[model samples]
Target: MSIQTKTVKAKTVAIVGGGCAGWSLAARVDQLSANTVTLYLKEETNPSHNWGFWQMPWLSDALSKKRAMWNSWQIITDEGIVTHHSRNHAYCSITSDDWFDWCQKRFHSAATTTEIIRLPVTNTDKNMLMTSNHKKRYDLIYDSRPPKADKNILLQHFKGLEIKTSIPVFNSKAAVLMDFRVSQENGIHFMYVLGYDQYTALVESTFFSTSPHREEVYDEAIRDYLSRIYNVTSFEIVKSEKGIIPMGDVRPKDQNPFLYSIGSNAGAIRPSSGYAFSFIQKQITQFLDRQTKPTNPHKKHDLMMDLIFLEVLKSHPEKAQRLFFKLARALNGDSFARFLSGEANIKDYFLVINSMPKWLFINQAVRVIIEKWKRIAKWA
Candidate 1:
């Protein structure tokens, strides 16, 4: 005779926010354990925008839906252009709408006990989440909301226009990672171009500054860059996208055991580069593998390096062009991509450190250390 054992019920999970992190976690959590997921979308749908990242094995499905890709990319400065090519990882772009849809399909196909609710989480008490309709308790809750912005924090802001030119102008094979030929009056300004085809491209005017410029400023810069660099006088704008990313730590203050902050709120956005897509994916993957709340995906050493780089950028905005140019020249395509994607090895880290201005970085590192010590003292 065999004795019958009791079956355990699935844990309930409520995920807040409809963006990349929320959807990503929701899609993959079933792999960790048997769980019922309730996804709370702030809006009925996600806003459409392009997310760019380097290709990786884990992201093969995403690569299938890429809008465009480049095996070779370049960084341009007044000094010259430095081009790098990586056969291992191609730079690819995917639209938010496509990504969200793919995530939804994956989640639904895998988990039958999932619900998608169109409501914003107003407040929380322990494991209980309050929505406009009702309050529900879950074993776990993941909040992917945008972090509150501070005026003093340096921000990476940009406005991109996807345009189609009548003439074959843009180079479709290579992407312009950073063109520092733009006006520097509005902080560390640059032009980023992603060419989809000879006649189509997404041109963005980007700035790393505390104070973002007006919409017209970005538009004017884009216009000037297109006319000057590409010699394009006329082009039809297909779509436009604008975003502002805080180049500062966004770790949550409250330590709720059942509640976790994922995505950018968990510091997925690199303080120096403002790259979040790949980091967010890394955070989710780790969370699934560990079966716990997501933590900052970036390595401590990488974060420290980013902090020092930010300090240098803040202190010497004028030197931004030269600094970035030097960095691009120092690393090949694979190393640069790995470094930016937070997968850098010791050699990659050494290359980055050696590329920077010695004295400036040392001074910044000291400043960062002192500031940390002061904060510790104040807290104590």
Candidate 2:
């Protein structure tokens, strides 16, 4: 009897994008493979961003540090307010700074070949990354760069204002996800926070297709939201953040020979929810597990949520915003709770999509069909 094992030579990975995805992928690749991993970061300072995931069972262990836990959210509607609570799980929020620090520290000690190159990457075949200092080649490349900003593409633009009040007005326990009492116009929605801090609260206003002064709009919305929800007025602003999440519903081509897309660039962001941290982690782990054989690449999930998501953003951005708010307003407390817990199934997702005004969906579908038909007619 004999036992045999084969060793596979590792490939060099050049990650050209230094957000959560770049650092995370670099760390994981360094940990899992005997390969050399280099992170090409856009910012020397860790960017201030927020990453939240549903209360996944594995997240407790996956996250290096725990920042906040929230069990309930206040969903506001034109009709009224409904409180959704889940005893089973609490949504977790982890700061990008913490994750980046953890990744840097882990990669330093992981023994796997890892480097963080502070530079920008150029898009080319020979050296996909072109820095003024040098050009580098990688067997595998992970690009996490944000899509070039375009007003044409419908996007989820948000501004988060982190406020610290002199006296505590926010509950230290419950997390408020959405206070829809404000305006749900032109596909914009408002999400308010009350539970993340002892004396701090985050008020966020989001728009689906357009970019306005998010900070300005958020401050105005918060003034109203807090006054309505907590009946409290003046609060001091400690810090603020604004981010544009490309709801780019378009699927990117496998552009380069060794290039692979990761993070939101790879379409990990849930089109419906605009959340991707947990999904990206799952995607990376599954990808690494399947990479044992060079010829066997990972299969993309067929759900094609991106396709539907893009269409909604392109044709019916307004309706999409309304639908999200409508569903949030209409759902029963228990079902909404389940949805937030990520326990809801595909059917639930579809149900929420279908819950919107049928006429609106129909009109949007008809418009898309007519455009396609016209294009075909012109081609013939």
Best by TM-score: 1
RMSD value for candidate 2: 5.4
What stretches of model 1 exceed 4 Å from their correct place? 1-10, 44-46, 253-257
Which pairs of residues clash in candidate 2, taking residues 3 or more apart in a chain or in different chains?
122-130
Total clashes for model 1: 0
Q: Model 2, which residues run further than 4 Å from truth?
A: 1-9, 44-47, 62-64, 126-128, 148-151, 184-187, 250-254, 292-322, 329-354, 362-380
lDDT of 1 by residue, 1-380 (tens): 11111221237767888888888877775774656788898864324889999997667777888898999999999999999999998899999889888888888887448898888888887888888989988766778888765568889999999999999999889999899998999899999999999999999999999987889999999999989988988899999999999997665544554567889888899888998988898888876776655789989998998988988999999999999999999999999999988888889888888998899999999999999999999999
Candidates in order: C-alpha RMSD to true structure: 4.1, 5.4
Q: TM-score, each model?
A: 0.95, 0.80
Q: For residue 274, give model 2's deviation from the true position in Å.
A: 2.2
- lDDT per residue, candidate 2, 1-380, as tens digits? 11111222346767778776677776666544656878887655534766766566545544547577677666655656666666655566887778777867877877777787887775546435677788766655667775453456656777777777777678767676665567665365667574566678777776666555546676677677777866768877766777767654534343654556777667666655566677667666656665532221112322233434466656654454455567776565546644544455666667656666766556655765686689899999
- Cα lDDT computed for each candidate against the true fold: 0.85, 0.62
Tell me how candidate 1 scores on lDDT. Answer: 0.85
Clash statistics: count for each candidate: 0, 1
